[model samples]
Target: MQNEGEWEAVRLLSTAARLVRREVDNRLRELGLTQERVTVLRVLAGDGPMKRAELARRLRVTAQTLGTSLVTMTRQGLVGELPPAAEGGARRVVDISEHGRRMLGRADEIEQVGFSADIRPELRRELVSLIHDLEVHRAGASASL
Candidate 1:
C-alpha cells in the first residue's frame, strides 16, 4: 500500500538505525560493554534505581532477556540488586554501581569522539523529532491492532 518513496524512506531509516547501533556497539566494545548494557547502565544512572520489570519495559526488551543481561552485569559488578522494601513487595530493584558510573563515563568519552560528534545540532534535533514521531505512530498502530 505504500508508495516507492515511502518504502525507500523506511529502508533508509532501518539501515541508518542498524549502522548507528553497529558503530556504537563497536565503540562500547572497546570498554568491555555492549550498546545494550551501556544503555541499561545509562538509564539506571540517570533515572536512579528501578524495578527489573519496569527497566525491561523502558529498554523495550522482555524480562527474560533483561534477566540474562543482568546476570552478567551483576557478576561483573556493574549493577547491584537492592533488597525489596518490606512494603513494596518482593520485586527486586536494580541500580548502577560506582563501577557502572565509571564505565558510563568512559562510554561518554567514546561517544564524544564517535560518529555522533559529526552530526550537526539542528540535524540531530530533526532526526530525534522524526524518530519520536515514528515511535508514537507505531505505538498507536500496534494498540489499534
Candidate 2:
C-alpha cells in the first residue's frame, strides 16, 4: 500500500501533466503544429542539425517512432534530410525548413500569450522552480538506476 503523501504526489503529477499537455497541444494545433512535430522542431532548434537517431535520443523517443515522424514531416516539407554528419550508414542530417521556422515562431507566440494571460506570474515562477527541482531529482534517480 502506498502512503498518502506518495499517492497524492503521483495523482497530482498525472493530472497536472495531462492538463498541461492538452493545453499546449491545443495551442500548437491552432498554429498548424502537432505536439509530436512541435517536439521534433524544438529538439532540432536546440541541438542544431541532427540525424534521426540523435533526434530520437533528445526527444526520448524510439528511432522507429522518430523515423515515422520524420517521414511525415519530410513529406510535409517541414524538414529536409541532408548529408550525414558522422560515419557509418547515411548521415541523414535533418534541418527545419523555412516554413517550419515560421510555424514554430507562431506556436511559440501562442504559448507565450497563453502563459502570460492564463497563468499568474507567481504561479509561473513556482511552476518553473518545481520543474527545476523535478529535473534535479530525475537526474539523481536516473543515476541510481
Q: 34-138, model 1: which lDDT tens digit per residue?
A: 888989999999899999999999999999999999999999899999888888665689999999999999998988898767788998999989979989999
Question: What lDDT does the true structure give each of the candidates?
Answer: 0.89, 0.80
Tens digits of per-residue lDDT for model 2, 1-145: 8664766766977876678778788877766678789878877777788777878987888999999988888887888888754556467789898888877777778777764357778987988898789889999999998
* Candidate 2, superposed: residue stretches over 4 Å from native: 1-7, 84-90, 115-145
TM-score of each: 0.83, 0.70
Tell me the lDDT of model 1 at 141. 100
Cand. 2 Cα-lDDT: 0.80
13 Cα displacement, candidate 1 (Å): 2.0
- Supply every candidate's count of residue pairs whose N, Cα or C atoms clash at under 3 angstroms: 0, 1
